[model samples]
Target: MCSTLPTEVQNAPQIDQDSGDTIGVLDCLRLNVYVPNKASSQNPLPVMVWIYGGGFFEGAAGWYDGSYLVKHDVVVVTINYRVGPYGFMCLDIPEVPAFGGDANSITVFGQSAGAGSIDLHLYSPYERLFHKAIVQSGSAKVEGMFINPDYSAAINIAQQLGFNTTDSNEAISFLSTIDSHLVIAASSSLGYWFRPCKEQVFDNVANFVEQDSQNQYSPARIRNTPLFVGTTSDEEYTYDMNEFAGNPFLDKIKTHYSLSDADLTRISNTIRHFYIGDEEISSDLLRELNDFKQDFHFQHPIDRAIVKYIEQGANVYQYIFAYSSDDSPVYHSAELKYLLSPKFDPLDESNKKDLLMSKCATTMWTNFAKYGNPTPESTEEVPVTLDRATVDKRSYLYVDDENGNLLPLTSLPRKYQNWGQDRDWNRGSGVGPDDGVRIDFDNRTVVGIRIDSENG
Candidate 1:
């Protein structure tokens, strides 16, 4: 069903130059379209737009190959947006171009920072540009995910480049002159430097913590958009943390949140008790620490988003990619290898399970893109039906080595009890652990329930 293009025809123009327009040139914004052989006006297939993630520092459309999804009778469009300080410096540049053609069936899928980008688009005035979204291993609610509009990091990057200017206009002019590679290198070093922000033009999009505080932000804003969000079993294992040995990591966390020594002790002890369970710090404590980081950064935020979306009467599907290979466990971005890997081999014995998982994932994803629901119908390869998440069952897809199945959200490893409601351990507040009424963590209940009851 797949046809290979001739070598000469395979070569497409690369967007390497900066436009130098009001949009701050560095115009690496382009779309790579993969259309099925049978696609035409008579048989226009659904389109899936991919947004790649590199922590807002680096990402490209060329990194992902959408040929696999194209083979499933869908048009796959991978797009490039300005990363680092260029695309998200809160400059008055032209907004990223919206996808053209069949807006009603467009599904935008992204991973990590790319997923976070999708989250921004969901709340932006241009949210109607797409009909569905799939957010993997990232959320708009994660603290520090979005940069502030003041563009402090941009100024810092400019200073490092010898510009020595804080004026926005002067900085932009100087930044426009620097080589793109040099600017990206300097911004990368600044880590958490350039990212999406709440600016005057689009102030509606706020981080989850801000949304919770204002009571004004609501999933109802994007209620018409169906969402599929999920995370890996070990989202943070991919990062090297050997540098965080001893108390340095704790110190870093305290500084990041502006927590006092006493607050840090309470929060660290709470995390330790939950993940390490009274075990003293040792070599084995690394895994527990990694899990804590994963939950705090990725999973907990996702859980909150899912709950909020469901409460808004939106169709949401959740998943936990627990599939592991002999060589690697389900680390962050591992599922991408199954979903978008160009070298995927289904014939090899070792790849049998991977192939199954990949097929299930691609099918479900493409199915969601084609139809609003993932399990609209079942086929021989995919017999089981995945269910949508609801307030009652909280059903979600559990993708494993065998095949995908609908499982209760509670069955997933790790619990997000008291997530945002716990003012002490949450990312937004600095209350001590002893300040709030004790919660029954064993019951796996959210602390919001108690607050809701008390207010009622």
Candidate 2:
């Protein structure tokens, strides 16, 4: 167990705030490396780089302890990258230096916004720095994930900071003089408005727009990188629904997406029919809303990404984390506690199953890091050797305790079967092997849904 001193970068800009002076960018970027007690540089074990997530606004490397993963004979690295406006403001600056390591044996993994960062890196010119990736509950294709050519939010943030100039260059110059803490404070208040933007070149760093135009998982970009992507069964169980309730929420959606008044009313009615049919906003309705949010934000985008990778002939593994305690029942980021921490108590009878599940998950993760496949060897209880995801198979590993082992799901879930029905973007298009109904994207509600006769 070895840790490095946090070394500040030279020429780092400072921001002034009421609290104190803070660096515009986190100058004290550090990488904490952990290796097994028996391992050494000569042996050169496989490396797993963990990126933490806090909605792209707040997160730190120190939050995650990789000691448990290191004990599995792999090198675990937790790194610090800039977050919010300072990190992703689309400014012309020196590129964030890459970590020095064996690029061939590196696997980059992260959860939520961290996962989104990995997606950006995967499409970056520096993608060759890592060999594989694991994206947990996030994707670049998700709506609003990448802010393309839209400096309005950033300009708004600067104006809020009392830098009212409209000229991009002048505003940026003034912003550089402000305190970093104040900038972050404004970003927090603005929410997801300040995030990574597309089409911007920073010191020749690959911009997101160019990469996104091409197939994200194509061999041309990713070079057939193996990927493990998944989401929790109840990813949005903890979501605060106040943001999306009532007419104001509808108005915001309409304005943001440029949805017409007619389209908004139609979509609202459809949403009500699917998620709140004949029910008040009760506990059951909340559950439905949670599922809808999860599916729309995390699950659907991730599933689409996985399918794209498979289509591009890249090795991919998909999973749905269903293991949860009786109290929490599979909330977002719940898997992190189990996978990262070794303090899982075996004495607690209620959590015994979770403890076992954690061990299995860790083993699979490390195995994938070492080898391209997750389950290279079969376990005794389940005797399951998980298959590589393919366009034909579309196989997904369902991680739960019911069978005490990984179970393969070949068919699309019922909810996902008609996924394209309500989606205005992918309307009139069929996904997977099934010839499902194709609906058109129009202003009218209840767009014609045509069921494939063969499947029906």
Candidate 3:
């Protein structure tokens, strides 16, 4: 594994698919290897396989540089996957061929849409390749799943473009004949949102759907691998493009959703309830739009998955990025520029808080990559434990300007106790997946976190 990595500064390894095929082998698949210098006594360093997300419609590994992790005693690998109709929609069909072959010890990491891919990949037949994972601003819940709401809208748009969505593969084959970028542009112009869909049960290709009767996503259950997951405090803000006086996609959104003002308001409130939590939101169309963004794009899915993982005894840690500034609104993709590059100076130069926060964030992440735990040193005060341990509820490390702080795992929100359990599951009172756990924040210390197994 180490030998295949790029070692010298001037000798970057070429991109290759796991099948030993070159980058060009699959038009949609791409991979890059980052080998750390093995001048030290130990070689064959740990590896991180990154997946980029563009709502599964657009994004490439080349978009995110891995030199950050590579410079810090780890090897980073990134890949390019098919996007839009050419990629996701095409892959769902039975006749479509699978790309990457078997690979091992891979750790999946991605943000946004890429993170969704990680969640889907975990259920894929090829999932065992990665030992663990890190997902940012993405979740494994169907609510978080990136599905195109407007199937008819897509079909109608295709008709306008002189293609047929009812016969999608035929349309795809015709469209594939054209340049990919051109096809994407043409599809978007007519309000056809390209992303992963509910793969049919028979084919089961890319089985990201909730019901996998064959147990495709339940790969014998690797319960030991650690998971680090979280989202920003103001993630919805990025969707608030109009708050910045930028063009609001209200018309475009109307075209896609076709909702009444009252319906839009209800949908907007639902988004606010999930993403912003109990936090107060400013009264504005932008805030409503932000809510819409979080509802369809981010919150519920991640929330559900985290809840399920915690209930299932998987080692899980969670955080909420609360830091924001004029230059950075704690929005989507802000963490990237920090995680991948230290030299990136925010518009208003990064303050001491920013620098300290960046360092703290990166340190915790690297520590996890090296040892699968984020704590800096071993201690009973904050032991690095997983799913079965209540200690984790009180053992979380909050990365902030104050050089970082560790909070008791028990201090997390009480809502977590009941995070992912379905209403039906919660019908009876017990401490398991079947039991619906509810967080009583006012009376309980873990407001939105830490499962209250007793009442739940």
The C-alpha TM-scores of every prediction are 0.78, 0.78, 0.65
Best by TM-score: 2
Off by over 4 Å in 3: 1-28, 39-42, 90-92, 95-104, 142-144, 148-169, 202-219, 238-300, 324-328, 342-356, 376-395, 403-409, 413-456
List the lowest-lDDT window of 10 residues for candidate 3. 95-104
- On residues 170-209, what C-alpha lDDT tens digit does candidate 2 reach at each position? 7677777877767767766665344666565567565544
TM-score of candidate 3 on Cα atoms, chains taken together: 0.65
Top candidate on lDDT is 2
In terms of lDDT, the poorest run of 10 residues in model 1 is 6-15
Evaluation by TM-score, superior candidate among 2 and 3:
2
**lDDT tens readout by residue for model 1, 1-456:** 643231211112112224422222365566677767776665566788898877775556666777767767777877777765666666542212232235457889999998877777766544266789999988776656764466466577788888897676777778778886677667655654566666544455433223321122456676766888888887777345564467643554464455456545655555456566666766667776776677667776677666667767778877888777674657778778767773322223367766776677788789889887777777755566667876555677776655345343433342543344343344322211343332222222223122222111
RMSD of 2: 5.8
Error of 2 at 107 (Å): 0.6
2 or 3, greater by lDDT: 2
CA error at residue 318 for candidate 3, angstroms: 1.8
- What's the lDDT for candidate 1? 0.62
Off by over 4 Å in 1: 2-25, 91-101, 150-159, 164-166, 188-192, 201-216, 238-244, 248-256, 342-350, 402-411, 417-456
- Weakest 10 consecutive residues of candidate 2 by summed lDDT: 430-439
Q: What is the lDDT of residue 131 in candidate 2?
A: 85
